[model samples]
Target: MAPSPSSAAQHRHHSSLPTVSSAVSWLFLSLLFLYVVYYSTILFEPAPTFTTTTTTKTATDCQDISTIESNTTRVLRFDTELRHIAFGIAASSRLWRIRKEYLKLWWRRGETRGAVWLDKEVTTTENENLPDIHLSEDTSKFSYTNPNGDRSAIRISRVVSETLRLGMEDVRWFVMGDDDTIFIVENLVRILSKYDHNQFYYIGMTSESHFQNMLFSYGMAFGGGGFAISYPLAVELERMQDRCLQRYPGYYGSDDRMHACMAELNVPLTKEPGFHQNDVHGNLLGLLVAHPVTPLVSLHHLDVVDPIFPGMPRVQSIKHLLESAKYDSASIIQQSICYDKKREWSILVSYGFAIQIVRGILSPRELESPARTFLNWHKRLDYTAYAFNTRPVTRNPCQKPFVYYMSSTEYDKTREKIIGIYTLHRERYPYCKWKMESPEDIDTIVVLKKEDSSRWTKAPRKDCCRVLPATKNGTLYLWIGNCQTNEVIEL
Candidate 1:
């Protein structure tokens, strides 16, 4: 089998031919596969299907969703200056505290584009940071006094006329407010957008205090809460303000005089619920939580209302609350009324602030609920006392719940008791109750004892009270049995 070298070489070459052919075939196949893949990806691949489902919604759900959609869409994109809104701030020299704390913030924000009407010119080194100051003395010559000697009427009437005259040529809207008033500028603009600026419009809301509303005309907007006047209306007011002031000599306040003037103009007051003149004193939890479905345009009497958050000053609290609205405008504007029929509990939610729980029977009238005193964060108590009333129960109030906390004076006295109550029953009873002993004092503490337990154990301060012993239908029946009578009253 010993062959020559040339023949052996020829045989080795013949054997390598098959291996070369095999490599070539594999390379050709890989190239074909790559070509097919490339073509498939580029030209033959299926287009992505974007299938949108049409949800079958209930009547209530449809309404809510529609309202939300409308609100979201209504947010317009425009420059703030395009509105030509001017602020007419009625300020006194004696209210230095307000001028320093609140006015400074407004000035820094640079939203107020008008002047502060003062009794005398303020010559200060910090004048650069302040809004325009128009001295009352300069405008007083044209002013008319009330025959009944109402100084506020005389001053406000003059100021209104002066502000209108000052802003008539340059501004489209003239906004009037007291020194203490705080305005949500964006919200105000949006609110203004709803109505035509060219037309005569007088926009405002009723006072928070029922008594004040009764004393003054409910039809008239509270000046402290702020009001907006269209250019045409302001011009009309400027022409007739002096005459109206002479006619309404018996009017008690500036608001009444303005109302009388508007009535004479045959222009009806347009109510806007967002402008809150916090005329009521005590915790604003009930009123705020049950706020009407609208944007909160302004909050007056910050001094009267408790701090919006805990461990913070009133000014800081207000600033924080206003800032919160920027993050969730839709939530702030939308109706936040929620109810749970099964538990017989009605929940009122004020976005980024407070929640109120009341009996379902008191659904719409949540403000009048016996459990209205169960404010979660009106005051900074213990972490255990603060309950997260926001739906879906995400976290404990102690764990940085999505709400503003304000300082409360009663935190020290109630902290230990609330903590102990939460620690003892948190595992067994998820719900907590706060039964207010005295209606006048919102800070008054009441200890709720468990139905079965004989010991008088304090209940968690926030989200207090639970419905007991669920029925087959999942309806909770609370029985009220009097000691003197054998009959049991069930609710």
Candidate 2:
């Protein structure tokens, strides 16, 4: 049958619309493919120039970010001073995703806070290809046969050594950390303030296993898994690179050997609380240096350890935990909502009852049977559960336009209460939605807050029952309800 225009429009609206779910899935697939390709190439490459020579190089060559050098000095300096530093990340083709993920902690587009990322460039040349050699991530045939991770260390060292040679100047200090390691940037600057007392300093987590190298009840950072040094310290460290590499051949899997090189050159090492490569959960607060995330640098054989906030996908989860601790025994700040960890969300259906459910108000009977069935079904049906889940697969949200904008309409001028079961409201409950004409609505229109991760904050201020700006370009679904009548109007 030839459908009516209104019926056809409605059917098209519901059937032909694209969803946020589809976009997110597409992005995840694309990145996964890139990551797979990168790692596969790195696993099976032949050994490089420094690998065959023993005692000529240290095992420090094997670790990623080993190519610390000074060639980037011209490109890094801004405003004629070394205010910003650029990290030249070398993600062996296999581990580029890991590198990308790790680097994201420091850099994200549109965020001009601190530091900048000069777009990543991969090494294309082969092993034994001198300064310009590239590393791949296909670790299918990797081994620990040589205690010194020769080939890997040499590749990483060449890149990092060159980066230091370029990026650093007479700035306060230059930090060298791993992609997996989470650095407390503010704390590092604090430690840098004290560099005058000691110029050529090597800072990192001390190794308890290598306790033989201690001095004055402690030794400086045992390795360079992750650490920092001043400009003079940087220069001094650079001078020892060749001799250190020559003596150890390739310090495969050994980052601290660079520290050992610094120690060999009489560069004094100081043990501070923050500069750590180990999981010091309790000590994170006061420490001057530490890897808050994984790939715990400065210390080897500790990469497999887990972060304190277990299973947390976002940094906010960790911060919330710390905040909960910080206010312990103090005034308790209540979160607006508490979500179930295992199950994503719950729907509570009340059958046309009381307007308010307050401390003394009448309570409505919830549909316990339907709720139970829905939860059980969600648990049992893996595919449906996954589709409904709200966890973000990609870290970069705005980069990939996976999620669509919500439809918004101005509240009726005569209404005493804003009662609507909006899809936006369902996803982001307690979101402040206010009308511009209502003088009393000032409280409802929340001010843009710092660190607020809500998207509704940017919702334009409107007068009449106007549709939100972005919704006009695509499909918009909204569920409006009347509080007094106990009826829902789905649009």
Candidate 3:
């Protein structure tokens, strides 16, 4: 078979073809092994997956369903109103009767939504203008080691969480307060509307006392003045607060515990000055007369402080102040400064509250500073303890202000303005020795006002006022409204 030349060439070609085919088969098997080794891990191993979680168990049924449609749905946004807030007011059986009156002042029976968490049951009058009452769950399982603090702190701390568990509909904010807390609801609605309820917000002010804030934290919202938690934050708190509270057995109060939980959740407090803890004692006239530029939201410890209006009872004085609030809530206790150039007089009008006239012209800086008319919470005589700047009552008797508290404020429909009549307080002061025309002779001040909270959306500014010409011999007139572009408050 190898002797013939053509047959030999064909046999040689056949042998080379077999060798080439054998090499191709070996390359194909090697490639198959390499592909199996490299790709088997990828084909059989697990892949990463994404998930959306909330502190809710109700959505478990919907977990398998695609979330695209739900996620892509339009978010509804609306202005925060009275109905959107759930007020969790902490009270005890011992103080319920007296404190319920304070609640009645602000609560509209059918309009407001919330429950008063009490330690024990209290009888409710029919058709009472108060929030529904509920007995707080026993908190004896939690430890409170602070010697001076009350164990009631545990139950109070759970009020927000308990309120969240109520499963309220369309709840945007969970507001917490003591039973004695006086809330200016209209102002609360106005201020809360400025924030986005969808985000986590711990909105409140710290204690007015520096010592109190230093002892606990400036970050803690003094619960007396009240604090607001966005619904999202409340829900998160409801999920873990029982465990959080158990961890902090040594915490002194509900507020500090709340601060600790917020810290754990990596949220910081947002301070607002309108919430006044009113930790100080005595007359609040000076504080009210020279309010910060912000709206007055809450006033606490009303029973401890003297009546806001001289010679009026605690409840009546609040009602007197609310008279103006009923007409123009955003402007209550809001300060405006202007001058009588002819008389060289400095005049201050605390809208819906009082009017103060001093004999000498003073700068805005001195006027804006709160006068030390009230004592500190500790009853310390030293003025340096205050958290904010304060001015001493003028030693010079003639320069001291002649005060006039608001006697009445009514909406003048025809005038399209509020006419507030501030009658002279006539508190006998050190008689003025220097010769000058006396504002004491002026029996009344009529404040003409136009709504000015339009400026609240931007940087908040104090409303501006101009001293109008005297309308009656014994009456002075002033007008308060938004500031003019070129106008400035100066001497």
Considering every candidate listed, which one attains the maximal TM-score? 3
Q: Alpha carbon lDDT of residue 347, candidate 2?
A: 19
RMSD of 2: 32.2
RMSD for all candidates, in order, please.
21.6, 32.2, 13.2
Cα displacement (angstroms), candidate 1, residue 383, comes to 31
**Please, what are the lDDT tens digits per residue for candidate 2 over residues 1-491?**
99999999999788755766688889999999999998888986676753221122121111101112222111111121123332333334455443434444434233212231122345433322112223322323323345634455444443345566555443545555554544433223333443452356666555322222332124545333355665566666666676675665534443544655676888766655344444222211111111121212222212333332223443433333323222110101111111111222111211110001111111112211111111111124222331112222222221111111111212244643222221211122232232212111111111011111111112321111111222332222122121223322111
- Candidate 3 worst ten-residue window by lDDT: 58-67
lDDT of each: 0.54, 0.33, 0.85
Give the TM-score (vs. native) of candidate 2.
0.37
lDDT tens per residue, model 1, 62-108: 02221212123222233224236888888877774455467655553
Each prediction's TM-score versus the true structure: 0.56, 0.37, 0.83
